[model samples]
Target: MDFTNLLATEVQTFINQNIDSDINRLLLKRSSFPNVTIQEIVQQIKGRKVAQRKFPFLLNENIIFPPNLNLEQASSQSTAEYKAKDIKGKSFLDLTSGFGIDAFFLSQNFEEVTLVEQNPELIKIVEHNWKTLNRKADFINQNLEEFLESLGQAANDDFRKFDVVYLDPARRDQNNKKKFLLEDLSPNLLEIEEQLHSISDKIIVKLSPLIDISYLVSELQNINEIKIIAVRNEVKELVLIIENKPSTVNQQPTTISCINLESDEPEFSFYINEEKTATSEFSESLDFLYIPNNSMLKAGAFNIISKKFGLKKLHPNTHFYTSEHKLDNFPGRILQVEKIDGKDLKKNDQFNIISKNYPLKPDEIKKKYKLKDGGKRYLIFTQSINGKEILRSV
Candidate 1:
């Protein structure tokens, strides 16, 4: 796809002028410029809109955006920058560069960078954008499996070895439905892990948050770290860092890092096996309630968190914790709460409802209580050692 006409000054200005325009109406209107169609112009407009938040670096002129699917799958600038912070090497290779967002940032610290993508048009767009941004990379339009095979078949003297290799495999299948298992991903990590290790000692793969950490630990070899990255308390990406280690030394436990970016929460790290021996102290309602962040919850360090923070778990299943005295710098939300009776909640009252390990969901609780949502106060419906309990934020 030639984006020359779409990069024209007038078209760029049009896209800028109507950044907030309705897409349906824009599609109904015909393009005034002969070189560009309404669809093309709208695509640029959509890209600019997404760039305003997702990847501000691409807001420059002549930067082309791919279709919605590619944009949707691309890593956000925050996450890419976070992942790239400690990564620096002489050579870097990105095996599955969808929109090149991760590649752009991850390759910054490397002296040499290469990007391989199966989509020709998307690769062209990425190449063009990289050039426009004054960054350099060897962009290859080829399937990653074949690329790995070629690298393996290279003559001994001509063989390449990147200091760091990265892959964010496509999680969607042919029907565009999302898949979570290691075997379901494109380029199938299980099949290519050995080959990837041959090319680079450090191989990093970004996975869907839906993937089970235990399954990954069991299937993958020599995993050094598993990072759970979240933005604003919402879990976003699960990154696995694999290193080629000797069989005798590979039995070391994997380190798990739970990070909640753009928040005051501290980063929580624990060994993958540490949670197994950790135990929790059960207690009834206390003065303050602690709710672990999504990343910590996803890490399943329920007992570990209670032990570390010196808080008591409310129940065996409930993740809620309580402490008599306020704990500073807990990596989650802390609210002053008190046990409340069901009769205390009045009809049509508005409160932020949180239901965890409870029989009814928030919506069902709302319906039965005749309550509205969103307010300064919170109604926590959960179980404690005594049984089902209701607590209200003070």
Candidate 2:
């Protein structure tokens, strides 16, 4: 797994030149650097290919990439950069430094940082890459438990007490089976709660989006905030911020921030209590329909969204909103409507079709009606307050 020699000047140049080269064909050709195998070159090429878009800054920047699985698991440059802004510290620690993506970004904010990883090879890789970028970080070749046990022996004893101890626990078990339970995740965050608090007053955790936020709030004592981070309306990660002090269920509700990184969408922030307390006034069909972005829907602020924008819910459980007046700064797509004949959905074959609480899904409707997706026109199938199923297009 030693790739230090593969990073020679001539080898890197070849990789950069053939970044788009067909991998198998390039592999068959003669190797310019006899010391580096064709397979190693392919790894470099494949890595850079992904980094070019997912991690634009790291591409062609002498950064060593891990295997395919590691690259897949590593945080995207966008998410890493976004989370970096939330962290504040003179010093911080990454409990499980996979490919050092998060650590690399966190280094920009923290004066001192510690990266703890069990894999010695990955430790060496990131250590070299960090040096090339003129960034200095203490890399510890140890597992999470070992690092926590030896926190007293941290690189700089003066900065032992970190401003934040960040961790994205391995959600897979020894068998590589995905586990959603917090107890199943290792370094088992719940098990190390006390030790983590002893080292740092604040901790930032990244969890699978599938993990229940309510379950997390019940299990962890000090949940200061729960952030749902999404890119392009696609939910990616659920970040939980916890403090050292004990907290109760009756304490102030967790602030759920539904953040959509898409430039065109709005970022919505609200409390769970707000959504629970508000009651929506149902309406029959209206002039416009508003659909929330995935992040906002994931945050479950259905009623709160309607209340905030002076919109009325279509039905109690439909999660569709309508208004006679268009709202500015809406968090989701707002479409002007004209009711369409359900039978002629086939006639309008090339329009964006959406369905909520309808008998047929968008795909089913498209397949049955011989419709093609996308265009200026918008078609929505939903149920109105009067129990009438409405199919509207604009």
Candidate 3:
């Protein structure tokens, strides 16, 4: 049977059976295969065949697509789950809705949603997927610039206004270089803030986790909240919240929230600048050491953390601080100091080692300490405590 003559079902079956043969790699390697046309191949595999065959395996079983979508750009289930929570019940306009994952999920919460996509093919796929899910949304096939311009005109006429304007800019070039820094973004927001600010009262911008949170906050003066979202304990996205204007209470403290989506409990909540927490200070030394939560670290709340946790900053730039005692309510890792070894872990054996905010990685520390991976071990290696100290539980 000729390969091209096969029915869609048969073609999918054939592809599935030979997936182990590296068909994706093979398809890319052949010069005669149309690079631009492979989108159809992907849509067929994902939309119809995968939907039918792997329906049980998917998290969002309601949404389906054609074989054309570049699965490489498909948002992960975790990101979808988080977006569902953040964008719910708010009138949100997605400025650059690639594949419509964020828009689709956010639509669940809001009375109305507008998804703008510049790519015609992606817009079509998103429409199909939305229809499959039986969800309704306004899909605009216009560039972000044009959409923003229209919104600006409407805003002047008291027509277009959104509670939230969502942006997840494409953080890659045609060559796929990682673009996480604010200055590196395309059609750069730095250049378009005036127009963007006019259309929306609040903006929620999603950024790559690789970005430095400090740099982003510094660049976007309107930002009021910074969320470091982790799914199943693995950090995924950094959400920056920017408002139209300052709040009525000028002294209202900024919040740095850490969300552990996979947790069974209420997800380890804490207030960074709570009045009581602001004046507190760490005791000089104690039995256990408490590490402040990741959001606090990302926020660079060094003074607040030092006071709240009663810990001392080990070094100026090193985020890790030292506390002799542990707070029962602290949200981060707690370690019991066994022994302090400086530049002599090489001579020690049977020690389980872990490193954080330090020059060396976990594996490198393991090799140096001559220890094996995994256990309820108490080995800690950090550069902040006066240049590479080892502390293990007694």
List TM-scores for all candidates, in order.
Answer: 0.97, 0.93, 0.73
- The Cα local distance difference test for each model comes to 0.92, 0.82, 0.62
Q: Candidate 3 on 215-295: residue-level lDDT in tens?
A: 765677676777887765566778877777845746334456666565542344234445234533322223565555554
lDDT of 1 by residue, 31-119 (tens): 98999999988988898899999999888877888899899999999999999988998999999999999999999998899999999
Better of 1 and 3 by TM-score: 1
lDDT of 2 at 239: 90
Model 3 global lDDT (CA atoms, 0 to 1): 0.62
User: Candidate 2 has which clashing residue pairs, if any?
Assistant: none
Tens digits of lDDT, candidate 2, 241-332? 88876554355778898888845777788876788898889987788888888888888888998788889998987888888888878887
- Runs off by more than 4 Å, candidate 2: 1-4, 28-30, 152-159, 246-251, 344-348
Name the lDDT value of residue 125 in candidate 1. Answer: 94
- Which stretches in model 1 have alpha-carbon errors above 4 Å? 156-159, 248-251
> Which has the greatest TM-score?
1
